[model samples]
Each structure stands twice: as C-alpha cells, then as structure tokens.
Target: MAHSHDSTALDLPLPARRHQTLALVLVRRLAGHGLHDARATMLALDAGGTEFRRLLVLARALVVDLARTSRRRILLAPCCAAGMTRDEGLLMAMIGGGGLDVHGVLTDDAGCAIAMTTAHALGDELERLATRNDWRR
Candidate 1:
C-alpha cells in the first residue's frame, strides 16, 4: 500500500525542515559505516533531537580541527558529536537537580582536578560515583 499527503508536512515534534534535514544528514553519515551498525549506534545512544543540534554545532565548530576526510571523522568523536557520555549526562542531571559547584576539566593523562574546595567525604562520594558510573574522568 502507498500513502500520500496533500501537504508536505511531517508529524514530528521537531516542527522544522532544518531539523529533519540535519537528522537525514547524520543518518546518511552513519550509513557510510553500515546501516545496521549505524542504527544500532543511534539507538544505543537514546539521544534526543537537542543532542543532534549540539552535535551539528560542535561539528561545525571543530571543522578546522578535524581533517577534511570523506568519512567525516569529526562525527566519530563521541565527546563532541555525542556531547557527553552516559555518566557525564547523569552527573549533569544530578548537578542540575542540586546546586553543586563541581566544575572541572578532563585531561587525557592527568585525571579530573576540581578547582573548588571539596570535603573529603564528598570527594570520596564523587570518586565512587565516577567509578561506579563509568565516567571518562
């Protein structure tokens, strides 16, 4: 069976052609890897539309940093493309839930170093949470 619409409208919450276009772009990019594999990655992320926007923005920002390869290697970086890891998202969720002033930057070799003063017990809790959550700290 075939379906037709009188008007060119999609019943998506995104409500903008740009949104659909970007999604299609990402899908096509992922398709280069393999449709099934790409879909699995997308589904595994369980990402929302806003996250897609974030990825597009980051990809555009780092275009200079990324090589001009046909594979679009910039999209492969989970940190920029996917924004935050699961535990990072969870930590943000917790921070947003409360008024915690946990500000820090992640270093490749050196590990997380908070600038603010943290109590020993709280630091231990944060460390435990980081390990348990499997964050990239």
Candidate 2:
C-alpha cells in the first residue's frame, strides 16, 4: 500500500502487514537480531490504541530492527515532520541494546529528498534481507 505524504496512517491490508513492511524496510540498514524484537514490539503496539500509536510503533520497530541487525553503525534519517517522541527514544534504546549505534538525521528542510532516500534505502535493505533468507531456497 502507498503511504500518504502528509499522514502517518498506513494504507495496509492489516496492522500486521503495516508493521512487517515498516520493520523490514527499517531493519535492513542496521548491523544484527534486534529486528525480530522490534517487529514483535510493533505487532503489540499495533494492537493498542493511543495518539499516533501506529506511527510510533512503526518507527520504534524500525529502530530496533536496525540496531539488532547492524553492529552499532546505523544512522536514523528521520523526517523533520517525523517529530521525535519518548517512544522513539525508547526504540533507540532498544536498538542500542542490540549492540548497534544510532545517529539521528533530521529531514525537515527536504521532505521529498528524505522520503525518496528513505524509500530507496529501505527497499535496498529489504531486498538484501530477502535474498539472504530466501525461504524458497
């Protein structure tokens, strides 16, 4: 499903789908197994209701996934519009716990660039992961 430019609400078949998609994309850049934990967190959060909970959950999932997979060398290129919150910080902490480094990259000045870059990066990561874990193989 296509995401809106001005909204956090995801257009997905189910909350799980949304969570998985976001998690898969976010985890690819990071360096180790934290992605699995992050995905679980996101799934739980997706079942809850709160202010921007879905978006927050998705963001956290990505952070944790990256941290778990990457060996402490992941940069968080967050959109400026993607305001930082306590949940986000918590997610960062989780990523850090997974032996990954986190750096923040704000993208308020260039929304389009940020969006494109994020999409590309996420896509690349997902593809790499899929290939590495080829279930069909």
Candidate 3:
C-alpha cells in the first residue's frame, strides 16, 4: 500500500508526515489553552522550517515530561481547572495512541510516567530524532 504518486499530505515522506501530525496535535493543544493564535500557529506550521522543527521538538519534550507522571492531571489541575484540562487529556491520548509510540501502557498515569521518563532520559537523542532533516519535508 504505497501511494508513491499521491498528491496529498499522504504523499509526504513518513518522517515528514509524523512531524506534521505532531505539529498539528501541539497546535490544537496550544490553541485550546488560549496560548497562541491558532490560525497563526497553523500558518507557521504550514510554512515549515527550522523554527517549526524546533517547535516540534519542544512539544515532544513537553509531552514526554507531562506523561512522566500520572499525577500530572491532578498536579496541573490547579493551573487551570479541577482536573486535567482538555488540552492535557488530548496530549496524553496522543502519546497513548501512538503519536510517539513509546513503549509501555500509557492508559494510566503510572505507566505513562515510566514511559515518559524513559523518553526524557534520551534527552538530545529525542531532539535529534524529532528535528532530523526528514522532518522538514
């Protein structure tokens, strides 16, 4: 099932597509939190460049960190609500659903915590993976 001739986002290389998905997920999360203009962020992602790559890396790192604790929802709840915000829940779902596909059962905070810790320990290695040339298109 190769769409070598497709002329859509599907036609993009695998790594590029992965980064695109990552970017979209982050953008939506940020928008939900009212941290940035969704339209502008999307435009920036559409433009795609070194800066976008950096953003993807940072987003990935944040996800990795937050997933580091199942208590994150509880801990961060005070930041904006009585429990996990919609955006936080979405990020957790993303990691659990194969956005990062890190090993372990991400369904629970405990498991997510362990898996994220493993990812965080990789540090620069993760950044290198997220910012590789293939991510640029």
Candidate 4:
C-alpha cells in the first residue's frame, strides 16, 4: 500500500491553490512590516474558505494602516480563525479581560514609504477580497 496526498501546491485543488497564493502574497506584504519567516507564516495560515477570506481582509487593512501610519510596530495577538471577525472592538475587549490598559496610537506622516511599496505590491486581489460581500461563498 502507498500513501497518496497532494505533495505540492500545484497538486492541490484550484481553490486551495488560490488560498495558498493569497496567503503567500499577504506574507510578503507583511514582510516589510517586521514580520518574519514567510514560509512558516504561509504554512501556519492554512488559508481557505470564509475564515481565510476574513483573514485576508483583516491583514490587508492592517497592512494598509501600517503603511500609512508611522507606528514603529504592530502587536499581533494570536487567535483562531473563528475569532477573526470584522468587529473592531474585539481587541479592546481582549485587553480589558486581560486587565491591560492599552489604547490606540496616532501618528503624523505626510508621506508613507511602506504604503508606496508593500501596500501597492499586494495588488487588486486584496481589494477584491476586501470588497467581497459574500463571505459564505
């Protein structure tokens, strides 16, 4: 008997491959923003379906914000895909529960270099994902 499985991204189905591509593109987008280990990040993402779509939308927004702002770094908390809702207050709730007094930061930057580079590098797929109204699909 021999084990059979998709050995490469190319071996996966079309949707799966698209997910992988999106994940890779996102990882690249984050690379300039102090994110490390592109390969590991891509693998850990395991992107697909609605949650994956949500992640893409959140990540693209975060990346865009990072690019535009002068924030030195972003603090990304670890959470499951199910927690990746569009609710902006979730992070604040998490912090409250943890007894942490954290608040948002504002920066002044006339021109953003990262926005010029990485945000634009993400291309139109991110915009498409962001604009998509049907997450169930």
Evaluated against the true structure, the overall lDDT of model 3 is: 0.41
Candidate 3 per-residue C-alpha lDDT over 1-137 given as tens digits, one digit per residue, 9 for 90 to 100: 32232222221122224443444445345434544546435644654554555454455455445544544232122222323433334434454333334332232344444545433433333344456655534
lDDT of 4 by residue, 1-137 (tens): 21132121232122223432344345444544344445434533554334454455544554556545644433332231212211112222221221112212211232444432333333334434434533223
Best candidate according to lDDT: 3
Runs off by more than 4 Å, candidate 3: 1-44, 70-137
Reference-based TM-score of each model: 0.18, 0.27, 0.25, 0.28
lDDT of 2 by residue, 1-137 (tens): 32222233222222123333344333332213343446444443443333234434444444544334332233333322233233233233333231112222222222223222333343344334434445223
Question: What's the candidate order when arranged by decreasing TM-score?
Answer: 4, 2, 3, 1
Query: In terms of TM-score, which candidate is strongest?
Result: 4
Task: Please give the ranking of all candidate structures by lDDT, highest first, separated by commas.
Answer: 3, 4, 2, 1
* Candidate with better TM-score, 2 vs 3: 2
Off by over 4 Å in 1: 1-45, 56-64, 69-137
Q: How close is candidate 3 to the true structure, as a TM-score?
A: 0.25
Clashes in candidate 2: how many?
Answer: 11
> Model-by-model lDDT, in order?
0.29, 0.34, 0.41, 0.36
